[model samples]
Target: MKLLKLVPDHTNIDFVRLRGWAFGLTLLLSVLAVGVTFARGLNLGVDFVGGLMIEERFASPPDLTRVREVVDAQGLGEAQLQTFGDPRVLTIRLPTQDGADEGATNAAVKKVSAALTQAFPGATFTRYSTVSGKVSNELIRNGVLAVVLAILGIGLFAIFRFEWQFGVSTIVAIVHDLLMTLGFFALTQFDFDLNIVAAVLTIIGYSINDKIVIDDRIRENMRRYRKMDMREIINLSVNETLPRTVMTSVTILLALFALLFLGGHVLRGFTAAMILGIVVGTYSSIYVSSSLLISLGLRAEPGEKKPARVDLSNAERIAPRER
Candidate 1:
């Protein structure tokens, strides 16, 4: 039986030739992502912002405006209500209580539950959580630090393992992926919580893994084809690795898509981020990272003085002197 092949054998494509266009599009998207993030801001969850979050479900979809009014009538604090998953399900958040004491928090929850039940019969409280200002601040700081450290570490690894060019290109690609994810969250107002933080770190890992494979192949090709042009070497290397890259990406995407649709709303944001990362990572590995090597002045054989070729057939063989 013939095996399935996503990319055919002996495939040759000029991936390096389109680096200019890829770089342009990447820059435009990164800029737009940054601008959108600063302008619209991310919808942070209680993990980052100190608050009391309560999940409640009604027998039927209730008007959010009316529900907000009912919660506000209790005068607990400012209530923010958003649909969680189903229309009938909603997550209500309120500002941290004055003292943030357990009694006050529980009392507040009871009051809101009573008010909601009276306002909308059959409305049931699912769960509630609280985060203090200090803890939330710490969480935000740690999340940022984790992502930054991961990027720096991965860049350094690339530099040591391959070349400085690889490191720089890897960093650039990762930053692009991160900004794009943030922009998506900012635009969609998805809950940017700790789970999303984990996803971002995971993306960095996957991007680096993909990049390292192609970088290794490129380095190997550079050594084997010392006299070859840099662009030709890059194209050859990427084409050679295209099958593995495509196969790996496709399989991972299959799992992520399953999680996205069947894993419920809790994993929606995380799954979405992973899917985008896979696509963007694969793209950068092909177009941005590999091609950028040539532009970074990486020659087929850097700093290597071409050795003189000796004619062995015409030269007399020297015999060993008798000991």
Candidate 2:
């Protein structure tokens, strides 16, 4: 049986020629992402915003309006109700008071549970969680710090591993990926929690991994084809690795899609973020990172300081030959 080929051999795509348009679109999207994130803000979950969350299941899909009214009437803080994986399931959230003790928190949970059960017969309280404002604040700080540090650290590594051009391009692409992910959450009103933070970090890791592969190829080509134009070298490098890139991305997307559909609603947000990240990461790696190298003054020649290697394969041995 003949194996299928995703990308043909000797493929020569002019990725650099379209850099102008790619850069323009990248800028537009990045700006919109940042703007949307600021304008709408993230819908933080109990993990980030310090709140009480109760997961309840009903024998049948209860009226959401009535459910909200009951929770609101309890005089708990503003109630945020959202359907979980199933229509018959719901997650209700209410902001917790600062410095609320364990007793007070449990009492609040009991109050909501009691009211919800009384108002809707056969309502089952599956679980509940509480986060103090102080703890949530710390989590937010740590999450932001972790993401920023990861990006910066990766950029520095790229710089050291290859060149300054590689590092800068990597950073730009990663920032774009993160902003796009955040923007998506802001627009969709998806719950932003530690899970999404993990997704973002994973996206960064995947993006850098893909970028490093392409960068290594580009650098190799630059050294081997010293006289080739930078544009040609970039095109050659990306095309050479196109098959690996496509295969990896396609395989990952397949698994992610499966998890997206089969995974419970609890994982839906994380899976969705991951799916978007893979697509965006691939695009940025091919179009943004590789193409930006040329604009960053990365050339096949000039400023190359490595010592030339001398081949002695055909040279006579200085040592005496065996008689």
TM per model? 0.90, 0.89
Candidate 2 structure lDDT: 0.87
| Candidate 1, run of 10 with poorest lDDT | 314-323
Q: Which ten contiguous residues of candidate 2 have the minimum total lDDT? A: 314-323
The Cα error of candidate 2 at residue 322, in Å, is 41
Q: Pick the candidate with the highest TM-score.
A: 1
Please state the error at residue 148 of candidate 2 in Å. 0.6
What is the C-alpha lDDT profile of model 1 across 69-125, one tens digit per residue?
899998878898877557888889999987899998999999999989999999999
Q: In model 1, what are the clashing residue pairs, if there are any? A: none
Report how far off residue 153 is in candidate 2 (Å).
Answer: 0.3
